[model samples]
Target: MNARLVGSGSDTVVLAHGYGTDQSVWDKILPDLARHHRVLAFDWIFSGAVKDQDMFDPVKYSSLDAFADDLIALMEEVKPGPSVYINSEGYEGGFDISEVEQLLSSIESDFHSWASSFAPLGVDPNDPPSVTKFQNCLKRMRPETALSVAKLIFLGDQRDMLDKVTVPCTFVQTTNDFVVPNSVPGFMAKKIKGKSTVEVIEADGHFPQLTAHLQLLEVLRDVPGFDL
Candidate 1:
């Protein structure tokens, strides 16, 4: 259960990468972050490293609560100390997280409009991130793994957990990003109890790490203690 660990420092900053990418997506910004805060990043169980397909039991990490738990566990193992920075998704969505419950409810009760409640990203879902490299990586994902994860992303509501995190949090939301959309970031900021900042970068791609790295880095540095 010892998740991947990277970097070290008192002001620990964990990077939570979004769907279709792993910890390495932060490669461009880590050097800058490592300059000041301890940065820890890891791939979620489905992002490719996990071998035990059964280990990805739907009951466990199939929800945001479970995924966040894995994150907290990694943080506890690497740096249990106070963290001044917790840069998450610093960008947009895999999809409407609450959609899973909605879909299930709709299915069970003869409702037909639940799926429509989700706001589309206003982009082609079939198209990959604007970055070619990311598209290439995604095209190579294990089909079963991706399908399983797609189902999981549509499930549950864990935005409430934001109220529990005592650490300072900053989300890097892209104004022009499509996959995660803008509203998802808004929901996250409102739910997380601690002081959180949101920077709306004028970026086009969902993988801002590649298409909008400098802007993201600029915002990252501008955030309170992220002076790294």
Candidate 2:
């Protein structure tokens, strides 16, 4: 796990990048976030930025729980004390089984081509640079690793685990995300046992940190525990 800590504060914020993205995705908002809190960002095992290709095992990491375990271990070693935890999960994650299968099939058939086609759809097409940035992130990943991780993310259902989340959570979402449906944040808010709220940034893509960094940062700063 390639992890790094930035800034200094009594609070800590861990930046966990979504699928097909690395720690670099947070670059736009990192400086502002670091001004108030220690931010920890890292690349996932499946990420292309990882130098050690052998670190990822398809069989062992067939579920999101394995990834969560890796994060927990990383946090333990890094000792990012008393951080505000942010996460999202649910059965209603905006994609049906058929949709997921189609996406996986597309990636399996030709990942590079799929990534080029998918990147614009995921990010705002108007922001050509951000779209290209995301596409490059996708293209950098090993095909096999990308396919396996895609399966794990699209197929896995973790609705039962929501009730176990007893800490406060702030779900930041974009107004028009191609990947995640609008209903997800509300569904997750209702399911989790903790006090939770959804902050919708008036942005037009899945990656607001790239396309709408200022708005994303404003929302983060307003989150209850992060106000400091």
Candidate 3:
């Protein structure tokens, strides 16, 4: 894990990138976040940007639990004490298993073609630069690795795990995220044991941090500890 610690403050913000993206996806909002808090961003083992490709073992990491374990270890190594926690799940995460399988099939059949088409669908097509940026990120990944991670993300469900979350959370979503259905954030809020709220960024696409950073920042600022 290539973990970086930036800025200085009483609170820390860990910026975890989504599928098909590396920590650089947070570039648009990181600076402003750093102004008031410490920000930790890292590339997961499967990311092409990670220097240690050997670290990812598909057999061992077939679920999000493995990834969560890695994150816990990374946080311990970087910051040994307690910190604010944020995280998720589904009543409808947007796609069903069949839909996810179709996506996986497309990637396995032709990753390059899939990335080209998927990137525009994942982000705002009007934002050509962001689309290209996301597409490049997707293209950089090893197809086998990408497919494995995709299965973990798209097919895996953690709804049973939501009740275990006890920390305050603010679930953020875009107004029009093609990948995640609008109901997801609210559904998660209901499932989690913690006090939770949903914040909607008025934007198009699944990646608000990339295409709607300013709005994303505003939403982040409204989070309890991040108000500073």
lDDT (10s digit) by residue, model 3, range 99-165: 8789999999999999999999999999999999999988988999989988887776778888998
TM-score for candidate 2 = 0.95
lDDT of 1: 0.58
Error of 2 at 174 (Å): 1.2
How would you encode candidate 1's per-residue C-alpha lDDT over 121-199 as one tens digit per residue? 3222333443444544443445555555655554534555667876566777767665566777777777777787777
| CA-lDDT, candidates in order | 0.58, 0.85, 0.82
Query: Alpha-carbon error at 112 in model 3, in Å?
Result: 1.1
Error of 2 at 96 (Å): 2.4
lDDT of 2: 0.85
Which candidate leads in TM-score?
2
Question: What's the best-to-worst order under lDDT?
Answer: 2, 3, 1
Candidate 2 C-alpha lDDT tens digits along 152-183 = 77887778888998888888888988888888
Worst 10 residues of 3 by lDDT: 82-91
For model 1, give the 10-residue run with minimal summed lDDT. 111-120
Of candidates 3 and 2, the better by lDDT: 2
Better of 1 and 2 by TM-score: 2
Clashing pairs in 2: none
TM-score for candidate 1, please give it.
0.70
Ranking by TM-score: 2, 3, 1
